[model samples]
Target: MPFLTDPVLTAGAFAAVPQPEIPTGDGLLLRPWQASDAPAVYAAFQDPLMHRWQLRAADSAHEVRGWIEEWRGEWATARSVQWAVVDAGEGALLGRVALHHIDLVDGVGEIGYWTVPAARGEGVAARGTSALARWALDEAGFGRLELTHALGNGASCRVAAKCGFALEGTKRSAVLYTDGRQDVHLHARVRGD
Candidate 1:
């Protein structure tokens, strides 16, 4: 794919793609994070499921506030794009989906995302991820995209599969999780050859 940055291809009026609000099948909407989201994020972490799947340790509201700020910084600098998820009907904060590690030169990037326990299995991750992947390839002009997860995370594997990522095998000692150096499954989706 030729490397060209078209302002119109982006979702909104920004030099780069303006983060758009994406709605999951189950009525979860993903938009940009705001300072007010800190409270919900802090609360979500208290769920053991969120802690286990999302690799989260204990965090305070202050830290979550700063975390939301950092994600916005990426858009400010044209570095990465993120989407903050909310329950569509209730409008309650849920989780986040992001396409970070962007390399415009090589037309490549990586995807990372996580949702609170209450938000999982509603097809939120798959829909959010597929939307981001299609946008990354068609709008962001990336040639290849990658996603990674620890060996035991079945849910993540399912999400990746739903988004058309091909499993590329395990990387031994690839990631050092809380359990020490752990192997990880690598998945990739490449644009038309």
Candidate 2:
């Protein structure tokens, strides 16, 4: 009999926890959030492209530190798992990827991510997103993954499509951007056996 067949074990909520590090394509590295990443994350957030494409507004140093603490807590407490993308060759952080909403009972999760400006057009986002989703579905037992983007963010749409996400639909005025309400496209990647 499988451990998954144990009633008591199955009754508890499965968590999207992270080990200190997991391997990327060429590096033996994939780690959860850390306070040290605050600076890099803040710098990445300052990019005009992310601000316009994402709903997040400008964050202060304090906010970035606080965000780091929050993310660390999630990883420590088994709520969510967030990874800082890093250079496989140099071992330097390049971006971030997260299993945002995890519902173990339902076997569903959501993936959100952004790459540093330098990493864009290098397939970093697509590769990182793909690796994270594979981990969730294959190792973490998630049955579904969802991603969304503002309709105007064509790059993100392309990445999602590349990762095998099927466009569910577009909802007008669904996402409230910092500037105003914007249209959103929902994409999903169903698990496969």
Candidate 3:
């Protein structure tokens, strides 16, 4: 059961330490999602745009709490991690940033984020995503990270560019949306870039 190469990251790389809070330098901080934040999470999902891009909608504070629990569990498994992007002073939830589809053996993960209706156009997504990317590629030892979004999602494209994730290519009919299948833009960033 041995491979020719060693894992790029140790299995317990993330689990070995407490999840650190990341500051975006834009009055926002990315912190662990809390059960008490369920109400805010639920409110954000009520936005039509937010619900459209997300894989699932939080119908109630209870569902959001469940999601927070699941997200916390992933940290232990080293499979994925999610953070609540909040106002640094007020601690109000403004958005979310996450690294999913993680592969410790390859040192890669996918980044995803969404901003609340009130936070849109405020650079919340860009700032939060940039902070997470730095942590993932520089601090966390990930060799590569990817950000993908539906072709029509121009805002997301801008966020990727702002965060230094170069557009790799377009994935034809890559994902299904509420509207139907759509082409997706694939962007990526690697260590030292």
Candidate 4:
């Protein structure tokens, strides 16, 4: 397939991104979200910290299920691929990770993740994030991956660094939260980096 010398950025024909079960080292696995996990997802999202950084809000199990369905829709449209990070040993949902803002033509995407309260301080986010990054860059053929976090989020910054994302800089008032606009730090990793 070839594009004209100057082509407009259209949605263009896109194949669905694969969503296979990925095994993360140390007994962790990344898999597609299931409707049965709605209650757990809702519980995780109830955390104040999660609400502070992430814009998603699901007050009930029904809403959480809808959000999971939305994730599947996004995946089918080639817009995003989200995975549920689980503990293989316990079969417990530990977190969620996603490769979104997918630009197939440009070979780029952005990563986002959050760990449940019980999974925090256990390296769940870092491990799951790194695993997804490898898959996105190598298997998915993405050339570059970007991760941005609120400047006040130290844990996210540390996770990004651990996953080999270099801190590019801060974007002033880049994110508008419910309270007010907040600055965000941009971190990036290239395919060969």
TM-score of each: 0.83, 0.85, 0.96, 0.91
- In TM-score terms, candidate 3 sits at 0.96
Runs with alpha carbons beyond 4 Å of true place in candidate 2:
1-20, 76-79
lDDT tens digits, residue span 6-87, model 1: 4323332234456667665557677899998888888878887775656666569998888888887777554577888787
Name the weakest run of 10 consecutive residues (lDDT summed) in model 1: 6-15
- What lDDT would candidate 4 get against the real structure? 0.87
Q: For model 2, how many clashes? A: 0
Model 4 over residues 1-193: C-alpha lDDT tens digits?
8765432222533343356788887789999888888999999889999889888788799988998888866766777889999999888999999988887768778999999999999999999999999887777677899999998999999999999999999999998987899999999999888
For candidate 4, which ten residues in a row score worst on lDDT?
A: 7-16
Candidate 3: which pairs clash? none
Q: lDDT at 135 for candidate 4?
A: 81
Error of 1 at 67 (Å): 0.8
Using TM-score as the measure, what is the rank order of every candidate, best first? 3, 4, 2, 1
Each model's lDDT: 0.77, 0.77, 0.92, 0.87
- Give me the overall lDDT of model 3: 0.92
Best-performing candidate as measured by lDDT = 3
